[model samples]
Target: MTDGIESLLPPAVAIILALITRRVLVPLSIGILVGAATLASQESSGPLSVLTGTASRFIQTIDQSVRDWDHLHVLAFTLLLGAMVGVLESSGSMARMISGWTRRVSTRRGGQSLIGFTGLLIFFDDYANTLLVGGTMRTTADRYGISRAKLAYLVDSTAAPVAGLTLVSTWVATELSYLQEGLADAGIEATNMTFSVFLQSLPYRFYPLLALWFVFVIATSGRDFGPMWAEENAAAQKPRSHHKQSPAGSWADIFAAVMPVGICLIVISGVLVTTGLQEPAESEMSRWQYFGHVIGSGNSYLALVAGGGAGLIAAGTLAIALSGVSWELVIMGSAKGMLQMLPAMAVLWLAWALSSLTGEDQLNTGGYLASILNERLPVEWLPTCVFLLAAFIAFATGTSWGTMAILTPLAVALSINLQQSLLASETLLAASDMGLSGGSPSGTAASLAMSPICLATFSSVLAGAIFGDHCSPLSDTTVLSSRACDCNHVLHVRTQMPYALVVGVTCILFGTLPASWGVSPWISLLISAAVLWVIVRMLGKHPQSAST
Candidate 1:
């Protein structure tokens, strides 16, 4: 049966069904069975022999995959991050920071600005962005009579979008390292493409940026979407009550929470810039040597440890001084906070495991799609198509980093191929010119001419992955935002989807279309942002009538 359905059912369908049914183990089993059945059918082997061989092979594959756990550094990083977040929250540092900021904001619009600004500041790290902004701003927004859904929207919108756009951050360092490895595998030089080039390409990341802008426009203009709009309307229709107590904290509390994060950002940025500029040696080292010497030798980890440790120490000191809590109570609170985070951390670990499982086969489904696209679609339409395809994949995976890691290299490869073909055509024309002038055309000129196209395609893929992650319900940041704001999970999803879709569709039409027409990505992005601003303004003025 597995063999029979192999051609009929798509791989994605199998994975999705398995996930929806809460039976991931079943899918892996089915995949193995299918592989064995297919092989046996091809080799004329008996069913029993096929089953035995397949089971053995599956065990071997699983063992080999498990042995590769050395590469799972992100898990360790996340654990440390969890511990740091626990310390900050337990010490009441984050609460004080939020209180101080919100106390200065007199109006709802001003409050929204503070939220957006905080999101931007925390963009250096997505985990920090989500935890800090969401945890801090929730109470502040509530004091301003803002709905939890709106607060969640603000936090979720800013988290991934801001982090994705930042050129000098941990997010970029991790992504760049992965992207560089992938490009190297394809015989491309990562150094040839500068960080400026990537940053310039970010305007095409329509979802997150648009989402951020939409939040500001909606908050200031008093417009809402779906359930959020209904909630606001209901709140406004109710009787007035006495003003709530000030939710703001003291200046001392704010400094304690923010100082460590600020120092970490500065240190990380300085280290990354210095390391990125180092020249490669004349002779290339082995894979292990390169990993150990260049990548692992960096002091960023030390910086993270130091920054987090300092934050814990400062927070503990502040708790004692400001709250006048006994040392025993403070220790007890910290332990409780750590325990509270365990469940969230468990979910994160499961998410990581699922991502790893999905990404186990490096067949480059995105690249395969790009190849089919090259054959079926016109060159001018490639960027737009790639954007949509990447969006769909990221949405399904609910992991932007995973999506970018898989799709960017494929897009880069496709761009190189497309540019080479265009250059060939141009070269043939040059040959005709040479024939008329009695001189031969040069092939080297053609190769140099195609570099721009490769750059454009790479940018498009990055943009698409971010767009999908921005709106994905399965995204961890999205989940954290909802939890932080204390909003209904489904309500948050329904409200944000339309805004994301509007921005995404417009980006596809304006952003990618302009790129296809040979406009510089920077120029195209500016124009796209301008266009988005107009649309957002119109929507803000006459918001759609919807219920929570």
Candidate 2:
């Protein structure tokens, strides 16, 4: 039975089952059972032997794909972030700071700007941005009658999207490393492409930056959409209530919460600088040396742990000093806060593991896709096709990082192939110009067919992936945003989609036309933004219409 079902089961079936069940152990078990039963049916081997062999293969595959040190570092950083957030929240320091600011601003328009600016200031880390901004600003937004959905949209829109675009951000280093490796594999010079070149290309990352700006513009201008409009309207229809009394917390309380985050940022920056300086003068360092020097030195993880630790200590001290809270109360609050984040951490780990499994060479879904597209797609359509493909994958994966990790190499490879084909065409075109000395007219036409079809496909892929992640409900930042604003999950999704779709369509058009027409991607993006502003103005007129 297992053999028959395994033989019949498609990869799509496997993906759907895995996603729907949301049970990592069950999905992995099913995958292994299917593989084993199929092998046993094909051969005369015993069931146990087949099962053992299949299990061994799976383990070996995982071992080959998993970067243990990278995983550990991610885990450490996540825990530290969660703990730090808990400490800050428990101290009520963030609340005090936010209250102080709210008292000074005291207007709805000012509140929106403050929230957006706060998101920008925490650009170094998306998780920090989401939690800090969300937790700190919820009361302020409520006071000003802003819908929780809108607040979540603002926070979510700014977090990962902004961080991904920033040159010195955590995402950049990871993305750059991946890009550099892919370039190296293609025998391209790494030094030829600096981080600055990537930054220049980032304006072309249409989805994220556009989404961020659009959200801010809409918020500040009092435009609303979908559930956001409904929520705000409903709030307006109800009798206005007095603002909640500000909680009692002194300036010292605010400092306690902020000091930890400040220390963490300072330490991480210093470590990054030192790491940059310590890098060998050579163009490329060995993978082992790179890993050993970075992880073995323990600077990055240490900075995070130390930051969280310091924050916890400071919070406790402040609680005792100012509020007369007992040590037990502080310790209990810290522990509870850490525990509260355990489920989210588990989800993070599962997502990471799934990404690892899918990205394996033997099981690479993106590579399979590249092969299919290579055969079926016209050379001219490659850029647009890759953009849409990456968008779909990122939406399904709920991670821009995972989407890029799988797609970037494949995009690079496709670009290189297209370039080679174009080079050959140019040679034939030159031959044809020389009175068909080397080839017939028909042959020249055939050679020139693919020349006009340039490969600006990678830019499209980047843009699309960011676009999808920007709106995806399953995305980490999206979840954080909703949590931050205390908004209903479905409401946040519904409200943000209109804005996201508009930006996405703009990006697609820019990618397809101007990008294919030999214009620089940066220039194309500027034009797209101009187009977006027109659309926003038109759609923003009836804020009430968005409620429907």
Candidate 3:
């Protein structure tokens, strides 16, 4: 499985089935079962034993994943967040918040921007961003004739990209850790260079940067293409329904909803900083390095749990005190919210199990893909190639973090060695002297600068991971976005793909490719944006106009 193309089977089965059937659970289950069977078949067992092995393998993966404290922490966070939402809804806080938002965001553009900006503001965790944005903004989007698919797109687009790109977020730690580990594994001293390289690589992360810009383009321009336009147009023609007043509505309804979210954000940020500072620091580490180190070492999942609990408590207290609701009502609200999350939790659990099956320990799907890039090629093409490879792996595995973990070390080592090998060759050295080194500095200065190939490939992994996560139906963030927006999972995937592809291709063409050839990333980004603007104006349609 590790060495063969058969490693790609499980995810292929799952993704193909999901597309054909337009369903999630059945396809995911079948894919997992198939993967389990493949693993089981490798053992010397009788038919009966092999059958039992398949079942036992499935059970073990789920059990092991659930037993992990990190997984439990995430689940707990989701549960608590759900409880907070329930309290808000049951207490009429949701309706009040919606009403307030509706008045301020009179048009579809404002409503969409509000959702996008809120997502950007919550740049700490993708899970929190997706859940908070999708759940809170769905109703307001509905009022503005925005479809569930559109809401899901906005939420999904902003969630991972923001978390991945932001200076301080749950993703920052994992990303830095992976990059550091990759550098260390490549025999590079990472003490000072890891954070520095990461900072340099940020500009090369064209997908996330473009994706964020594309979101606002979609938001402010009020134009859409493909299935999203159809969804939006249909939604526009449908009469807007008035929200029902809660029997327990009060003057503090808006306060009740907004306060809990604010408290959650504040508590999470406070915990992140505090916990980060608590980690062991090196005297030699600079202020920025120490900051990155602190964040990279902090217990982010714990912070999520603490923040969720605090928000839940605030919501319950607000329901009881401000809304003057009964303790029973508060309890029910909490229970109700938690219950609503059960389906998504189940999806997450299955996703984790499936991810485990495809992980380095199991099928080694990522490893197989990594092995294919062993052949040498032009240095400038590495970023584009790496981006595509990372995208495919993430799409198959449905986890951006997993894809990064698998590819980062390999990409770093490969790029460094390739560059060294090329520099050693007389023919290549002559070309490098002739300015074929992609605008790299000459002589000793070139040695001091970060390798353009390394930086671009590094950023490509992050960018591609996000790209695949956005389009993949099996992705947890995608699932969370669908769940939060209350959109059909398959529908969300289907509608969002066109918009994702448009930005994805544009960035690859105008951002990564040119930038790799020594074009400044800022210039590439500007060209990409201008191209995207042309695309939207030429290809996109107004929902209201299209409906008429």
RMSD of each candidate relative to the true structure: 7.6, 8.3, 7.9
Q: Candidate 3 at residue 95, lDDT?
A: 55
By TM-score, the candidates rank as 1, 2, 3
Top model number, TM-score: 1
Candidate 3 total steric clashes: 0
- Please say which candidate is ahead in TM-score: 1 or 2: 1
Residue by residue across 160-229, what tens digits does model 3's lDDT show?
9988897545555456555654554344653445556777788889999999999999999989899998
Tens digits of lDDT, candidate 2, 309-355: 55556666766786566777777767766676565444333333333
TM-score of each: 0.69, 0.67, 0.63
- Relative to the unseen true structure, what is the C-alpha lDDT of residue 217 in candidate 1, on a scale of 0 to 100? 68
Which residue window of length 10 is worst by lDDT in model 3? 440-449
Q: lDDT per model, in order?
A: 0.56, 0.58, 0.75
Clashing pairs in 2: 226-546
